[model samples]
Target: MMNLAVFASGNGSNFEAVMEAVKSGAVQGEVKLLVCDKEQAFAIERAKNHGIPTFVASPKKYSSKEAYETNVLKQLHENNVELIVLAGYMRLIGSTLLHAFEHRILNIHPSLLPAFPGLDAIGQAFDAKVKVSGVTVHYVDAGMDTGPIIAQESIYIEDGDTREDVQRKIQQVEHQLYPATIQKVIEQITRGV
Candidate 1:
């Protein structure tokens, strides 16, 4: 089975969804580690609840972001992580992390992209007056959310919908889409697809 290391920087709703998928055999993989940049992120609790190993490699602790990420990579390597999943991980992954894992890193973003690529994606979509916006699962690259697309789901935004409303819909899509894409990635790895 593919051994996954999940990265998160916040409340970990997406991380929890992935854990549920794994527990139900929907993901067809094993979660080997849960890594977070924040010391008190709720993701660590989620990992502990599911009996997954957890680690915190804060960037502020290291002299450089690259050094902090190197520490994370070292822990992942020690845990035998084969896939890295970014579920609400706020930090921008750099060249070293990308080189260490290559195309094995995957991220779920809150936009159809390359429509609205960065923070407050739902708000951006709302301000852009786009009728449709949703979720994207893509390969991680050096650029910010500019990696090759793997999958995307678009939700139609109704008239006068608030950013919160749009975000809620997008989050629903994210919960389903991330797990589905991760399953596909696992299949590709297992079958050499």
Candidate 2:
């Protein structure tokens, strides 16, 4: 089985989803570790509940981004992680990690990508009043959400939809799509695709 390490820096809804999916064999992999950049992130708590080992650290405590990632890389190696899955990890991956993981990292974005790429993507689409907005699962690259797209599923924004409504829609899609995409990617990784 592929050993996986998941990174998150928020509420960890996606992290939980991935954990549940893997537990149910909907995804083929073992969650070897959970890496969180924030000590207070709910993802850490969720990881604890799931009995997943966690490495919680703040980049601010490290001297540089490379130093922080070097520490994270140590944990990844210790856990024998084969893939890095970014659930809600808010930080930009540094060169150290990018080089180490390369095509091994994958991320799920809250927008159609090439549309609203950065933070608060759901809000960006809602504010723009776009009739359609969706999720994008992609390979992680150095640029913000600029990786090659693996899959995208769109959702329509109704006339009276609130920002909260849009947020809920994007999250629902994320919870479903991210796990499914991870499963497909893991299969490809196993097949050397």
Best by lDDT: 2
lDDT of 2: 0.94
Expressed as tens digits, the lDDT of each residue in 120-162 for candidate 1 is: 7888889989998889999999999999999999999999888
Cα TM-score per model: 0.96, 0.98
Off by over 4 Å in 1: none
lDDT for model 1, on a 0 to 1 scale?
Answer: 0.92
Error of 2 at 60 (Å): 0.6
Model 1: per-residue Cα lDDT at residue 134: 86
lDDT of each: 0.92, 0.94
